[model samples]
Target: NTTPTAVADAGDATEKGGVANGSGGVVASGNVLTNDTDPDAGDTKTVTAIKFGATSGTLGSALAGTYGSLVLNASGAYSYAVNETNAAVQALRLSTNTLSEVFSYTMRDTAGATATANLTVTIHGANDAPVLAVQTTTQNATVGSAFSFVVPTTTFTDVDSGETLAYAATAADGTALPAWLSFNATTRTFSGTPTAGGTYGVKVTATDLGGLAANETFNIAVSVPGNTTPTAVADAGDATEKGGVANGSGGAVASGNVLTNDTDPDSGDTKTVTAVVFGATSGTLGSALAGTYGSLVLNASGAYSYAVNETNAAVQALRLSTNTLSEVFSYTMRDTAGATATANLTVTIHGANDAP
Candidate 1:
């Protein structure tokens, strides 16, 4: 008998003519085949394995040839044969534990046979738990001034297993954070007081159950104190006249000195008046005579004015004296201008000495 054996080249398969003797027939098996073309003459034929179906499959002995009952491994050992007259095509699924199955094979013949290839699979787990984000109210702050900030209460969660995470803050400025800040592990809330002010770059680190960690840093700016001017009050005794002299004659004049004018307590504006007297006097003598003066005469209105009386006998006698024989008297007029006024005076007598 003469038959055709299937051979696969790359993915395509072709049927090659096969020769046989009257009594002996050709058989294809395994990945390679050996056969006798002429039994009497000892001629031989060889066939290469063919690929079939969706993958690779074994060739069964149901299609007998000259070689006594050929055996094919179910573990994808041989190529597949085409269905000469097919009502419906069937495919073969490659199994494990075989080298032939390890090599991927595509379908070359759909009607005859089909096969399915095996594939290795892998799945990665979810990323480590998500880290909580750090929160802050301000980056810079003033010393002695208070700053308020809040840390979220929600803990980080892993996409795969969903577990709470832990966190801590590190002061990169080489100082410790104040204790006024509070922390709650259950709520994952963090609150703290920062007493010191400066450029503090702080880092907050968060860790999860899977040993994964994340960190964030923040900068703070602190300001110094503000400027303030001193207040001054002028002292009474410390104040001097426009000439830089203290409160005295060459400085401030006496409050009641008729000879000197007084000045304003602050502005130094002087209050002045001409010389004038306010008083009365009396006298008597055989020759010329003089008398001492008395207190000033003030009008009913309290205003001052000069007053002298010559109506008295003593005063008339003093005026009548003409001989060289004489009497002398002097008087001091006391100022009666009161505490608030100054008094000035000049005096002249109109009496003469008598001569015998």
Candidate 2:
């Protein structure tokens, strides 16, 4: 057997061999196998490995038995054993599934040569589900407000390696969650805007691919602040209509207070008042405002008007105008929230006894 000799930095040097994840095996040899023959005789000498040993560097301590440490015998076969559930095993598995080591060997020829190379092994580990514990038992959120809280990873722990976790939130009592609150299962987070105020019972569950699961319950209380109902401004009765001399020009006129009486429950809320009705429910007041003798007209503020005498010239000349004009109407008050209140209005116009 023809053995190739190794040349170190200054010439003679040694190599160190290491265990491959305790599986017990030589990953690489210091020299490559080769064949040489005497020119005239045509005799060939091939590579023959003679010695294998740990020239330097100590193997890691064996966890249980000889898991992490490596063992190489003279024949070149190596061996090792590791517990699947060992913490070191889990750490190595999590870090890229590989362990680094070095080993040395000598060839079987006249010049024994040795070199060292890296040995790496991919480690297999058991998978497991994450375990969870509740860090917060109660939470508070403002009503009608958006909220988000990240579930801390420290709250959960996993014994087995290589696990990704998922989270889900539900009502402990099995009641459907309010439309406001929502959960992000992928991020293992809880988030949502609360619409109403109330004490809600909820449970958060964490699960892993290994089908391991844990749950924790907490009360989420939504605080509801006192709300005020809109104020419907009371209108002081309209001005008293003065009694005129039968059908005379000085007849008293009246109008409902439109803008002055409108109000909102919230001080900052917008409110609007509109005269929903101009005259009686059964009849149209006239073609337009003030068209009929007693036609009623509405202002932007909800104030209304009626003409005492809309009769023709001849009727006025004969003093035969409407003696009394009466009108009934409705007004609607609205707030920013679309809430509405309606009111009725009645007004009678007195005349001096001639009919138009």
Candidate 3:
């Protein structure tokens, strides 16, 4: 076989490897080939021969003469024209009939034209709910004291979307609530003063943008005060009698004689007297030495007493002589052995009852 050679006067080679004539290889009528439409002068007139046959045994055999010159269809599909000039083997894959064709096409070439298959995509819902976290100043407190705490602003969140949340707090027993209590919405904080004394149950619930909720509960206790009293004692030893009065005579009287006597000077408003009496001793009228008066009313000053006033009647008689006289009367006397001994008396002689 002889190979075709370019003539010395040929202008250029066509895409089919043919020498370019003056008008680019004779316009390629029927069996003629040309590169009149090629954008570059180096393009040749060499045709890309394609044969439609199964490349592997998995597909059926191909028809004889099913080889041809390659031509791109109007819809961008490829077609081969009949040709027997130079036979060649080529693989042809059928277009997929399922939705997987688009995937396959996309995987192979992302920039490829859209396929005619219908596609559906599914999306799943998020699997997260709101969460609640709690905090407080103290778990225990005394009555009428302050109990404070804070609920974090970010207490609840949607795990998938990360949206802001809302929340509120409630006391188990409304009657036992704190005296001064309030809540802040912006900061989600709680503060209050507990006026009552007892254990309180507190609960908080948080809600997310999706309306999902969560909650937490806790306890607080308050204590009460104690009791108080007083005590006293008396001093009985502080009360005592000072002393008794003494006789006015220069000599100590051996027998019961009329003498001035007084109660203890230090005696208070209330007084208690304790005494031992001697036996009776008296002297008759004008008698002097041996015996002394049995009884005497020497003086009566402040709440005084006389033995003659007693019902026993130990004295023989009672007498009062002067108003200002210190010794008013003298009666029978008593000995130490309690026997009547003597009587002493002084009788005044009046001149016909001197009335002046």
TM-score of each: 0.28, 0.33, 0.28
Those runs of model 1 whose alpha carbons end farther than 4 Å from true positions after fitting are: 1-112, 117-122, 126-146, 152-163, 173-190, 222-356
Off by over 4 Å in 2: 1-85, 91-124, 159-161, 226-356
State the lDDT of candidate 1 residue by residue for 1-88, as single tens digits: 2332333322111121111111111222233222112222332333223232232333443322211122344333443332212211
How far out, in Å, is residue 350 in model 1? Answer: 99
Per-candidate clashes, comma-separated: 23, 16, 28
Q: Between prediction 1 and prediction 2, which has the larger lDDT?
A: 2
TM-score of 2: 0.33
lDDT of model number 1: 0.30
lDDT of each residue in 154-217, candidate 3, tens digit only = 5443343434567676774333334456666566776777665444556667665546566655
Candidate 3 or 1, higher lDDT: 1
Candidates in order have lDDT scores of: 0.30, 0.45, 0.29
Report the CA-based lDDT of candidate 3 relative to the real structure: 0.29
The superposed Cα distance between candidate 1 and the true structure at residue 72, in angstroms, equals: 25
What is the lDDT for 350 in model 1?
31
lDDT of 2: 0.45
